[model samples]
Structures are given as structure tokens and as C-alpha cells.
Target: MLTEELLTLAAAAGAAVATAAGTDAWEGLRTRLGGWLGRGDARGGEGALAELDAGAAELLADGTPTRAELERYGAAWRDRVITTLERLDGPEREEAAAELHRLVEREPAAREVRGGDQHVQGGIRVHAEQGSLAAALINGGVSFSPPPPPVRPEG
Candidate 1:
């Protein structure tokens, strides 16, 4: 039976792996995750890499993955991680858990926006000969104003 801490780590790792799939950070996360799980074993690391690739590919191919599919992937990775954790000795388990914590803490890729309120109807053309082309500079430090007309005293 897994302890509370180990169970928490397993859950987090599962979510992180699933969230990372198909993201820009996918490659880096996959490499580090594989290496971590590999535990300095070349063949193990290679196998992990292969698994990550296949999972990522499957997730991406779905276009819009269902929640069930996501859960399935997450559960699988969690089980794999739990198995790995169980194999290690006490100190090794601590080290591996620490590494997994770091991996989870790393930032994930930015999500892309699907839709926006922005609309465009016609082309916009602006020609600037010299200093500034903007008609108005709002909410900025720089301010632009026309020069004051030449002061004239009474003749």
C-alpha cells in the first residue's frame, strides 16, 4: 500500500503528464520525466521515451480529447510512477520523489486562445513621413501635442 505522500506524488505526476501532452513544453518534460523514471538505466530511459512519444501522439491525434481519455492517460502514468517508486529503496524513493516534485513544479506551456471578440472589416493604411504616426497615444508615458502657434506682440 502506498503512503499518503507517495499517493499524492503519484496523483500529481499523473496530472502533470496528461496536462503536458501536446503542449510546447511536451518535449522537455518528456525527456526529463523519462530520465527520472529510468534511474540511470539506458534501456529503461529509452523505453520511457517511447511511451511518452506514443502517449503524446495519441493525445494530439484526438483533436479534442474527452475527459475519459485524459483520465485514462493520467491513471496509466500514475500507476507506472507508483510502480517505479515502489521498486526503489527508502533513500532512493525520497530522491525520486524530490525529483518528481521538481518536475511537477516546472511551468507548463502557454495555452492557445481559440476565439476572440476582435473583428476587422476594411484595410487600414498609415503613412508616416517623420517623427510619429500615431494619432493619439493613450495610457502611455509619452505624450504628443502640436506646437503652439508663434506668439505675436501688437505691432
Candidate 2:
């Protein structure tokens, strides 16, 4: 099994390759990540993307990633492509890389806010937090707690 760092790197690489080599290349990642994802399976039939869907809930639910982090991930992949081209010979290099760059420019979803975030990671946290807060007052979820003392923690 690949380490967490390797898996994240592979995911980022696959995303880049999906951008450069197109989505077809991402299938390899699906297969490679599939087995690892399956290790935790109780059902033994769920797909990698499904596991990712579950994982995204945990990571992104905290908050949306800062725009800068997303930008850095994209930039690093583009740089990898650039570095690859720099090592190649001549016209063929430019032509091939140009094609990949064209594909890159034609990204399937130019600005999708992917993964979980408060806005994107809907369902549980947003609903639960709001519901719990409301219930705490009305349903007395915190009924056992004493009234605030005059010398308060905040003060």
C-alpha cells in the first residue's frame, strides 16, 4: 500500500495527468487507489470514488480550503508539465507539450470548487450544527449546566 503522502501525490499527479493527459489517464489512479480503498471495506464492493466521497466529508467539512491552497496545487502540476518539457529535445517536444497545454487550457470544469467545504460539504455538519444549536436552547440539551457566574471565563 502507498503511504498517505504517496496517495495524495498520486491523486494530485492523476489530477494533473487528467488535465494534461486528459481524464482517461485518471483511470489508472482509480485502479491503483482501488485496492487500498478496499482494505477498509466491510461490504467489499464499494468503488474508490465512493471512498473518496466519504473521505471528502471528513476533510472538507471543516471549512473550504483557502483559494490560495487550490491555486498552489494547480500551479505545482503545471510546473511539473513545464519541467518535463524542459528536458525534451526540440520541435516534437514543443508540439507534444503544446497539445497537453491546449488540453490543460480546455479543462473540463475550469473553476469547479471540488471536495468538501462548508458550502460544498453539505448534509451532516451544516444541518447538525444548526439543529443542535437550536435544540440546545429549546430542547435543553444543556439543561444540566449551571448559570454563568459573575466572574466569567471570557472576562
TM per model?
0.66, 0.31
For model 1, residues 1-155, the per-residue Cα lDDT tens digits are 66876776776777778878887777888898999989999999999999989987887795967888877987898899999999987888889988887776673311110112223344334567778675532343444467689999989
State each model's C-alpha RMSD to the native: 17.7, 18.3
| lDDT for residue 31 in candidate 2, whole number 0-100 | 42
Question: What local lDDT score does residue 10 receive in model 1, on the 0 to 100 scale?
Answer: 77
Report the Cα lDDT for residue 33, model 2: 36
On TM-score, the leading prediction is 1
User: Which regions in candidate 1 have their CA more than 4 angstroms from the true location?
Assistant: 107-155
* Model 2 lDDT tens row, 21-78: 2235445443433333343464532654554434334334556545554455445443
**Model 2 lDDT, residue 115, Cα:** 24
Please give the lDDT score at residue 105 for candidate 1: 64
The per-residue C-alpha lDDT of model 2 at residue 77 equals 45
Candidate 1 lDDT score at position 38 = 96
